[model samples]
Target: MDNFWFNQSDYEYEVVEPCTYQNNHSVELLVGQYVHSIICILGFVGNSLVIVTYAFYKRTKSMTDVYLLNVAIADLLFVVSLPIIVYNKLSSWSMGPVACKLLHGSYSVNLYSGMLLLACISTDRYIAIVQARRSFRLRSLPRSRLICAIVWTFAFLLSVPTFYFYNWYEPLHTQDVYMYDGHEKNLTTPQFVCEFRFTNNSTAWTTKVAVPSTQLAVGFFLPLLIMTVCYTAIIVKLLSVRNFQRHKAVRVVMAVVVVFVACHLPYNIVLFYDTVIMFQHQMCEASDALQVAKTVTQTIAYLHCCLNPVLYAFVGVKFRNHFRSIIQDLWCLGKRYIAPRRFSRVASEVFVSTRRSVDGSSDNGSSLTM
Candidate 1:
């Protein structure tokens, strides 16, 4: 939740330049735990619904739908881990090194994968609209699938370091933790918490400087750059078109760009600030301020996972229709099973996918691009 390896602490750290905050952390801790729990539940359900609706209930799909399906899958993968992160942050990491490695790796993979998929979606949209008459070789569905595979493979490879560095270390002081037995008891003991560390100085340098810098650039900035350019070009092209709903297309493009920047920019800014502080060895009150800022901003970014479905549900007409169909089918199913053993009236027909015109209008799925 707090980036890949960064965690907040209420007490001063011994070997790490005494990175402690002067403010009372009780509010932050209490709010963070519950918010994480709530977001975990909502994000899981939202992402799962997106995937299920697109995968099963929708019989028709454009190239945009394929990209969105993968996006939903990636978000769901990360959403399921929020509860574990909540437990780890509220309590300590009790799941051992294997669990820590898996969680960290999954987080990194999910982060980069979602960003890359958004970039891909934007590029696909650019090709679909701006280069609608050109770039014939790149618009095929099979090509889109190949591009997605490449994106996933690249994201997974970039995140492999998280698996390697997620090792445990013993804290210098004893921690008071609760134990489960016949009855609950609190006891003091030396505990191990999850952290990213390396023995060799060179490896440490790479982990601290190179890996995160690359993540900051490729995972956050690059996708942002891609979307900005793509949407700008899309807007220009939309202006030139005299027919159809060009204004709607431009508004949708702008909305995608705005939502992405709104959700992700704050966290990246704080992350960059944290990196600068760490690299500069600035152990001052500013460090305390940045620590708090980082925690707050990271929470904002975590909301992005669930926000995707909400954004789509509002903007995409076909997505809303598909969701309505699913709800109606569910209601009819519930009425059939619970209200009576036999059908009292003719069953209502449920349409899985929304109908499209002969011109292959993509107003349904185009709103999904970041």
Candidate 2:
């Protein structure tokens, strides 16, 4: 039988008995249901706010704004797939093969695009700050949009493997032996699982190693390297400047890099180890440990989606002000719709003053304080 999950290493061991390993069904269920539920809800809300603030409220969009808006869109797409994933883990993929491929393909596409857009954001910042006058034209709105188009196209291309390989599979497990008339028959039940299924054993290396390695190299390491270099230069530049916000800007950049590493590094490391072990035979205990680690670390990595808006957008003073304005406007609109007379004059005055302050303090450059 083919591997049941994408993260499972390519190895087979003799099954001497059923229930030989410790059961962690309850723990898996808890994490799959509760943890993922919370991530889905928070990621949805946070990314939605970012998208709304950038797409509707902002009259002028900077290069960074364009990159961030795409990042948020990628994140929202990924967040939408969480419920299906969680449900699949707990029960079965009732959605069939086409839905399975679409969901998994979309997940991979967004995962790659989100990370790439973040790298683009860093590159744009580097151009805008470190090489400002020399590269002004490079950071134009039209160019940024063109770059975003390329990112989406490239991401879709990268996800072609997932789209081709992922499908709903029902693997049969032998339960017991039964005597029927003169012969004994093995009774088995089928459990549905959505995973990568290769055409033949010859493609095991491609499915087990090449696919995941590509994901790691392109999705994590490349972007991490780009961000590290860009931010390091940015920090050095900030130190040479006499601006009061330089220190705060440096802090924000550091936080962004640190959080990215903290959230993704552990999972990538685990996945790397898992990939390496695919070549060697392993005991059941070792395999079990690796599988557990992959699940837990993967969940932790998923939290990064929820944290993106906070790290990228909400950290900016101007973005926060814009977000506040959106909230205030929604509040005022709700009050007016519910009870027009109850919409206090003082509330209107406060709202007007807030908008004035926001508009006055905002710059034509990136909403990011840097």
Clash number for every model?
0, 0
**Candidate 2 ranges beyond 4 A from true positions:** 1-24, 174-190, 341-361
Q: Per-residue CA lDDT of candidate 2, range 236-264, in tens?
A: 99889988788889899999999899889
Instruction: Write one digit per residue (lDDT tens) for candidate 1, span 1-370.
Output: 5657644675657664455565525535855678776778888888888887766666324566777788888889887876776567556678888888898889889899989988887887788777767646666678778888998889889988888887866664444556687664647654677878788988887688767787889998999999899889989988888855777767777777788888789988878866766657665677677777877777778888888776644367666766766676677767767765564343333222222221143444343332
RMSD of 2: 7.4
The parts of candidate 1 lying over 4 Å away from their true place are 1-17, 20-28, 173-187, 242-244, 312-314, 342-345, 348-370
Query: Cα deviation in Å at residue 294, candidate 2?
Result: 0.9
lDDT of 1 at 264: 85
Model 2, residue 229: distance off in Å is 0.8
